[model samples]
Target: MRQVGGIIFIIILMAVMFLMDWYVYQAVKTLLPDNNLVVGKIIYWTFAAGIGLWIGFTFFTIMREGHISTRSQLSLNLFLTLFVTQLTVIIFLFGEDIFRTLNAVYQYLTSTDTGKAASLPSRRKFVSQIAISIAAIPFTGFVYGIFKGKYDFRTIRKTVYFKDLPEAFDGFTITQISDIHAGSFTDYDAVKRGAGLAAAQGSDLFVFTGDLVNHKADEIDPMMDSFAQIKAPYGQFSILGNHDYGDYTSWPSREAKQKNFQSLKEKHKKLGYELLLDESRLIEKDGQTIRLLGVENWGVGFHAKGDLEKSLRDVGQNEFKILLSHDPSHWDEQVKKHPKNIHLTLSGHTHGMQFGIETPVIRWSPAQYRYPNWAGLAEEAGKFLYVNRGFGFHAFSGRVGIWPEITVIELRKA
Candidate 1:
């Protein structure tokens, strides 16, 4: 049954990709001048060839890696096909006009329109394109280097005086890190850097909000020492994310997946973290109690398996609560309106995949639309949500505006 379902999903995904590719090709072709048949053909063929080569190369590389069998090759191939197709589509959609406009400006500058070239719309467009492209080349190279280097580590600290903090937990500081996808693109250096940054904050408590590994539990074996360095006075706690469940990749059996999860939880224990799965623990300070609730991956339409109600069952309603949830959507739909209001929710499933500028006034990530409170701090119904951008890079293996974060949150009283 699982095999059948997987096959059907692959079929649907491939159909969508083909349709998208066709749509983008037709759209771009329509925008070009009808007289420029050669130019249009060249553009279309070039894009097609680039996409084809990318797909072929990806498959060849995967086969060479020998991690997955040919029987499962279709699944991997589909991912590569879609990724490359989308990348090509975006390049043509955004790059074609810029290139054309630049060419026109260069022609005008070298032609008879020297005085008016500065004022002409075409000239302006050309100059803007040239400037942008020139700037983009180095920026793109830097981003590529970061991706290849797999060094997406950053620290964010905010000061909250002891007076501003809740009476129960004054001078309390929490280090939150999330989305350490420890697989092909991540290593001990990245983890060490993240831990070093977190440790430098001098946090009292450390919280890792899921996605410790990309696929399997064993994948984290290499980074155990680095992760162990992340220690705080209070304790370190963690929850499971969707990726941590090993859903994206195939396993031999359900039992295997369960075993992997159990092993991962055990690994977290070894790393000095109390792995919370629909459970809560209390931290007492100066005779006051604060509850820390941790739940498994639960999100709308994705994975809604986490049981928050069960997790918070033992805790008192008035106690200040901090929840570690993997998906920000959990806070939006469940945590905000719970019978006992969770004072703060920390999540990190969204790695801000499409990290870029929305406009001059707004700097945003694509995850923002999918998740109401996607990144940074947001408040709703008196409850606060801090969605960490993530501590490691994924799939595309890069970070843009939404860089990897080691969030040091200082709790304060209202």
Candidate 2:
């Protein structure tokens, strides 16, 4: 039954791709010179056929190996780039078609003969030329994203003030990173550089919100040394994210899955991160202490294994508390409205959809549609949430304007 379903899905996908190719090709032909039409068609169809073959190979590889190779992932990104470009071209061409149809309808209403009314205007070469020209923007962006933008790590520093913050801990800094989907990484040097940047922050504490690996525990083994470079004066703490549980992939048995989960936890230990599972830790300075709580993966639409109540065990009502939860949805769904006051919540998992525009004056991402606090900081009722953009790319295999983020937050007593 599953195989049949898979076959059906692939058939539908190929049909859609073919339709897009045909429509885009029509516009493309308009731009081609009459003398070189044959050459242009050969080049365009060959490129499209290569993409189709790559997709088929990827699907077969996944079925056989139960995992996607880095090469296949990169190919997938290429496919997405071309797909987006085709959509842009199609949008312009579709508009032209609509205009032509509307003009034909208007002509029909005033025509002397019904036969003449059936004729529609030919597509304008100018429109096709403009469409292809505009499509280059996204094509260039995707190429840049694949080659350079994925490794374009940036350090974002923020300051959060709270009246209830422990006075002794004022000016305390924490460096946070999240969603290191190490399996998707092809460049170890860039990964190490990002980790080195985080360590250079020299923060009082360091924390990883979640997602150390994409599917398996072994995925992170290669990048272990890079992440180990990140340390803090206080300590480094971590919690699980949805991907950390290895739930997305299939295992031979339940025990195998459990073993992988255990191995992932040990990876954290080897990296010197205290793996906090529904637990709290006390950080003391100058004879005053604040609480740091971490919970397992919990989100509105994903795994909800995190225990906020258990993590808050023994936490004081008035103590300055910081919570580490992987998904920002936790803040909206539970953390903010909880009876106990969690002064600040740190989260990731959105990755700002790995594409967006962010600037001093404006910020926008498709991720915002799904998550209100998709990236950066949001405060309500004096409680704060900061969503780290993420440390690695995932399915898209690249980052655009959002970039990969290492966040440094300074806590102040107001």
Candidate 3:
């Protein structure tokens, strides 16, 4: 029944997409009238048909195969890029349509001399021209995102003040990255550069919040050496994300799934990270200490393997603590109001939807609608949560405004 419903949804989506293409085609005609640019028109419709067909094929493949191949990943990226371009054109053309309709209604209502009301004005050619011209911005952006933006690694530095922070660890720096999604990477050098950037931060401790792979355990094999290069004096530690459980994919048997999971854990060790599964570790510097806790993937509407209570075991109430959780939703639902004061929580998973605008004056992403603390830092009741945009791209294979991030956090004593 579920599969049938999925097929129905796909069919409806394809219909809507094709209709959008047809509407956008009218605007294309306005710019390059049927008489002109025969080859361009052929190219436009061919590309549109290709995109629509590819999108349908990709979804069906995911539904049947439980994962997308590398080629399909590229197709998804192209489809998304074209979708953004088409949607932009639609916005302009739709606005012009609204204006035309309103003008016709207004003329009908206030006509002092109504002579069968003049036929509704034809769409001005300039409107479609402007729409096509303006749409080039996102079309170019998506193209750039596909080729360069995904590897445009940026290191974000943040300093947080804590009143009760241990004096020895006053200037403690922790470098964090999450959601590697190794299987999605196409460029080995770019991945290395990102890891190199994190290593260059030279923080006191390094932590990976979660999501080492998209599905299978072997995904990280190629990049193992690259990531293993990032090491901190306090050592590298990590926790699992929902993807690490292999829940979204099909496995031949429970035993096969368990083996993949075990291999994933082993990969973490090979990368020099201690995979913390609902566990705690104390970092001591100059006889002072801070507790670092890591929980499994805990998220609302997703996996709930994280056990906050178990991770909190044997820890003091007033002890300074930092938690590594995969999903920001966990912090909102559980970490914020825990009986013990969890001073700080680091998370990823939202990836800022891998697209959106972020500037000094305004920060926005589609990820916000789902996870309130989607990107950057959020503080409530003196507890801080910093959500890394993500260290890698997934599913879509590209990022627009939200570039991959390498976070450097300095813990300062107030």
Candidate 4:
């Protein structure tokens, strides 16, 4: 009887998801009048059926096995089903466009003149099509998801030798880990592994650039021990990301959200991190002082409320400074052109959610085009920005070419 009720509940949930998909498809189709309605209908039916079967099978498998099943067969099936469906929909929607783009690429390659090549459509279309096809596959999304959920680790280790050193802190190593979205979906073991990885990187200082939890601070309370493991001789410091403010979900009032933010700040302190909210701290090394400044989420056209100037007001203009900001846009708009030079800015709001190929020269995330300095080390006008891909997964629950990043930056004197 219990099994029957459970199955019924699963069916209802599946029906809801299918209806949602159908509604979305209809809404989208209305925008493309020239689109093949037959193909759209076929795609919609395929998606609905695929989602239904996937959800149904998942529930059945769960019923057959105990709550803590080791096989993970059902999960795999569900993942594959979603992946295949996504692939099918992508192909259905963009198959002709991809073919056309490929033909254009072939023509460009076969052509002789530089002008002809210049006139040729940039490889963006073909590359985007291929990337979409790859991501559409269940194997790709599922495998990446498994690794991201399990490992809780990714790193960028680049040897950047600086010609000049700052008198205060030459050869300073900073370890930055960001976007640890601890919540209902993230496994405890993964969090533990992530903290372990962060601790293993021997650095003078540790910084968590933000997005501690997906929703509420309470969601992260159980995982405090995991986070506590991240420590350094100097200290572990943090700043708030947009999500840390709890704006996505409903809070009874503005006061409630403020309370939640305060709780998250306290939680960070409890985990042995100095929560820097529009504030600055000085690190003393070798009898010289370097300033560390952190700001609230301030992005152009998004949340441009963070006071970068105010945060750096107390710090000396000539002091070597590192800024912990959540949004990369902040670096582009404010820090890059600020009268007082900021040496290095670390951020990780762009989880590289759509992690895949952008072009021959670039592995792209949707975040890249939106922000000037989207990922990796981007330098403009003598300022350096390193955008960590992120420490954890969100929304789609996967990582592809843009894997979860753990950045170990060796700050050199110039």
Best-matching candidate per TM-score: 3
Task: Point out the worst 10-residue segment of candidate 1 by lDDT.
Answer: 118-127
Q: Score candidate 2 by TM-score against the native.
A: 0.94
Give the alpha-carbon lDDT of every model.
Answer: 0.72, 0.91, 0.92, 0.72
RMSD of 3: 1.5
Q: lDDT tens digits, residues 210-282, model 4?
A: 8898768887887889879888888889998877878656667899989998898899989999988788998
Local distance difference test, candidate 3: 0.92
Candidate 3 lDDT over residue span 258-290, tens digit each: 999999999999999999999999999999999
Choose the strongest candidate by lDDT: 3
lDDT of candidate 1 at residue 18, scale 0 to 100: 57
> For model 1, how does the per-residue alpha-carbon lDDT over 188-270 read when each residue is reduced to its tens digit?
66567767877788788999999888778887888888888888888999998988888767678999989998898898999
- Model 4 Cα displacement at 227 (Å)? 1.0
Question: Which pairs clash inside model 1?
Answer: 165-412, 165-413, 166-413
Backbone clashes, each candidate: 3, 0, 0, 4
How would the candidate models be sorted by TM-score, starting from the highest?
3, 2, 1, 4
TM-scores of the models, in the order given: 0.73, 0.94, 0.97, 0.70
RMSD of each: 8.4, 1.9, 1.5, 11.8
Candidate 4 C-alpha RMSD relative to the actual structure: 11.8
Q: At residue 46, give the lDDT of candidate 1.
A: 76
Candidate 2 residue-wise lDDT, 95-169, digit = tens: 999999999888888888866636789999999999999999988888898889999999999999998787888
Say which prediction, candidate 1 or candidate 2, comes out ahead on lDDT.
Answer: 2
Model 1 misplaced regions, further than 4 Å: 1-51, 56-142, 145-150, 159-168, 358-360
